[model samples]
Target: MTGYDQILAEVCATGRRLTRAELESRRLLGERAAETGVGLRVLVRQHLAATRTIWPTLGSVDADRVLAAVEQSIDAFAEGHERAQKLAVRREEAARREFIDDLLYGRSDLGRLAERAVRFGLLLTRAHAVAVCQGGTPLDDTDPATRQVESALVARFSERRVLLATKGGLLICIAPADQEEILAHFAKLAHAATDGGRVAVGRAHPGPGGIVHSYEEALHTLDLAERLALDGPVLHAVDLLVYPVLTRDRQAMADLVRNTLGPLESARGGPQPLIDTLTVYFDSGCVAAESARRLKLSVRALTYRLERVHTLTGVNPADPTHRFTLQTAVIGARLLGWPQTEL
Candidate 1:
């Protein structure tokens, strides 16, 4: 209100509206106030007080003229204040986006990243777990569904150190390793808000690099779920650790798939139907009735498929000793996307 006092007094005495230059000066003052963290309401109150103080001294001016001048000046000031605030918000958002990208990808200097992490409510020194949601529709920061989850998370866990963001078209939440409930609630909210989606939680690891590891694990869990056609909507990387181990040696897994299930390709419909039978059979825990029910097949037809598998593969899927080999091969096939992927 440095220039505001003089301008208001002059307008009251002269009974004239502010000139364009005077209004522009007021706009600049408002921008400065906004940048310096002064509340607009507070500034407006000060202007009103100044107007009242100058009112009696500036004798017999046009009351309507002074009021109009005051209104025009305040509007210009508010417009400038809002413009400055909007710019600040955009800058903050850009910085946050950059920080998250660097933090998750481990692309920046660790010390720098750790320092930046503090600004975003993260302690890079502590262990963190990442949970990712992959749904039918891709989610981003601007999505209402994503914002709802973020708001819910912040409301319930405001004191906790957590960050929710979007990466690779998926919603990602990073939380302290010890705060499993945070990830769990994030998954719950994500499922509800997104209509339906798979949420994958990665095992917690220590330090900044740990976040990268956990993020990768979460992403891999989602990928594995898609590749394996897993039924569960929520997947934990720790529980699915065997998948990474199984796929560690890609060629070996491919060979196992090709060797164990290769013979079934000679059947009338290629290997897919037989592979499906084996998958359902193994998934059903050798329960022929359940497998038949799941596959919508008669018991006899299911048995015939089993027998056909035994005849072609030379191993009885029902035999306990052979079950291990067949089941392991079936899992490898699914992981490698055997028939569809030329494995």
Candidate 2:
């Protein structure tokens, strides 16, 4: 091992605290590795495993004599060691972040990735799933519940083969397989911690490529939920796939609604009854009697509503082409939050 490695081993064996002699040696390393005294503050805190922490100060006191060359050398050694330690930590952190970014982006070499995964308790060959959670985690790995998720970076969830990190303002996590009940429970704890953080989970898939697929799907679910103004603490991609596909073209959707259903909105007061009538009519499989029964409207009134739809939209529900188009438009309307959207 190198001299620096030996020094670290010695430090670790020294227990919870350090002596004045040890501090003196590290101060020099701190000075050498740190660009300035200001950045050295961060270096010192990291050396102490505490953020923004400063060295203890003492009140003014009289000293008998000045320090000798040996004393000065000892002080420089301590300072330099501290600085070197911080620099080493920064390098390791950057490398780890790069690996995670590569894995998430599907750019990592599989053989190397698998080796790295093994060191981190991840078996990449197993089934995997991804989740994109919005917001920060309330609890750190010190809690036993999050121990399984805890990595050197303090990323975690619960008992599952999982990796976690925050990137682009989102908490991206990968877990072994998709366990709906377990994930749902995790969702509850997470939301409770943040008082309402949104989460999007993807279906589980096998192998490394599957992990990438899950992450993309989860991200897609989040985008879809945002575009559609959907609300829920946790949303699954399976539940949201249809809406995302249907609303891919908002302009086209708005235009279709305007040409097909806009007329009904201007009729008799507002669009509520017309929307309700159409929904019920379709729900009843275009059977006037069944729709009337469900709507609690007489068959004559239901027919009149249908007739009004035909007169305004120039599309009769009886025509298969017209019925299919109108039904698609209504579904689009709901997904795009139409009429209410002022489109």
Candidate 3:
């Protein structure tokens, strides 16, 4: 048996358990733990001294072996102690998560918890923003990818305090104090993961109490953009509000063609039919044959309309320059949401 095994067996035979208190007392008697605290080498020397006192008649090799066994025991004990400490920390972390869930969802006293977390320096007490990203896949089932993405984001924004969680297909992030920086970082990461899958981003909002508010706004913006078939990979909240204006403005520009070329519409028997023909004409890449087919008019009838349009609007229907002018007027009218007075 090893020297440590013999010593441990003897202690067990004594029928008195060597509690931590007893071990500390023995350490004090030899100043072992104290000297070791100063330096690990000092602790090794103290162990050697203790070994000689414990076994005086042993030969040199036996003494060295005994000392080595004791050192190994010390290392094992230290490792066990560290492992125990980590397990305790993990348990405390689990409890903290439970508490946070209760407080954030309003099941517990949030005010009290907030004050305590701030006082204990566990969390910042100020306002924060919540950003939710949908990575086009379930994060729970894809642990490795989720971890890789989370690690990248953490490394990229090490200075910013962020809390991340995964629910369903969403990667939820709580950013403290610097929402814009976090959002931009997330956007870049999402773009880099283009080959992985499509990612949809939501808006960011001020927090403390406004996290949900902002998260909802971002989700709504994403939904609107998607419904309208906006280009993606990165969808901004403001774009939803802007795209409609551009679309409507394009139609208004078409209206201006009919209004400016009024004499042409009158000859065609009505402005509306002529305007519809012109819209199809411009929208179909200025192809006279396509516009004539769409309007169910002969090519000759379409040509007459074009000539009248040129005369009234002082623009050639066939000329690229005048085509641009007609297109611009339609866009301006739509964007301005023009009434008769504005037109």
Task: Give the lDDT ranking, best first.
Answer: 1, 2, 3
Top lDDT prediction, candidate number = 1
RMSD of model 2, in Å? 10.6
Output the number of the TM-score-best candidate: 1
lDDT of 2 by residue, 1-343 (tens): 0133334334334422335665555565555655444454454344444211211121121121111222333445556756676787787667767777777787988888888877555788998887776654444324432332333223334355656655666666676774555456555555554457788999888877787888888888877777555778899998877776777888888888778888887788677688778877887899989999999999999999889889888888878978988987777776666767788
Candidate 1 lDDT by residue in tens digits, 25-109: 8889889989999989997898788878877876787888778877888888998898899999999999999998898889999
TM-score rank order: 1, 2, 3
Which lDDT values do the candidates have, in the order given?
0.90, 0.66, 0.55
Residue lDDT tens for model 3, 263-337? 453454544455555667886688888888978889898988777767766778689867876655543433443
Clashes of each: 0, 19, 10
Clashing pairs in 3: 203-218, 249-331, 249-334, 249-335, 252-330, 252-334, 253-329, 253-330, 253-331, 254-330
Which should have the higher TM-score, number 2 or number 3?
A: 2
TM-score of each: 0.95, 0.56, 0.48
Model 3: runs farther than 4 Å from truth? 1-68, 75-79, 92-96, 99-107, 116-125, 140-142, 177-179, 190-204, 219-230, 237-343
Model 3 lDDT-worst window of ten: 334-343
* Deviation (Å) of 139 in candidate 3: 1.9
